[model samples]
Target: MKRVIARCLIMVVTLLLISGCNTIRGAGEDIERGGEAIQRSAGG
Candidate 1:
């Protein structure tokens, strides 16, 4: 029972970390795209 609880906790933490990383990565991509769009508009 103790082992099961430990495993669950580890799984939850891992998932949270993964999700946080993904969110940051997604935000970075959005910013990059916005910059590109602005550059294109300015160039044209």
Candidate 2:
């Protein structure tokens, strides 16, 4: 039915968004760490 298809589509989209958020958070943490390393090397 149309309702069933719509529900499935919503669920898939929700899962994709949740996964994307985690990916972005992980990338941010990595960049922060790299910046910290540079600061330490510079004695700042």
**What local distance difference test score does each model get?**
0.85, 0.87
Please write out the lDDT profile of model 1 over residues 1-44, one tens digit for every residue. 99999999999999976775578778688778889999999995
Query: Taking the tens digit of each residue's C-alpha lDDT, what string does model 2 give over 1-44?
Result: 99999999999999986775588778688779889999999999
Please report how far candidate 1 places residue 17 from its true position, in Å. 0.2
Question: Pick by lDDT: which candidate is best?
Answer: 2
Give all TM-scores, in the order shown. Answer: 0.50, 0.50
Judging by TM-score against the true structure, name the best candidate: 1
For candidate 1, what is the total of clashing residue pairs?
Answer: 0
- Score candidate 2 by lDDT: 0.87
What stretches of model 2 exceed 4 Å from their correct place?
1-22
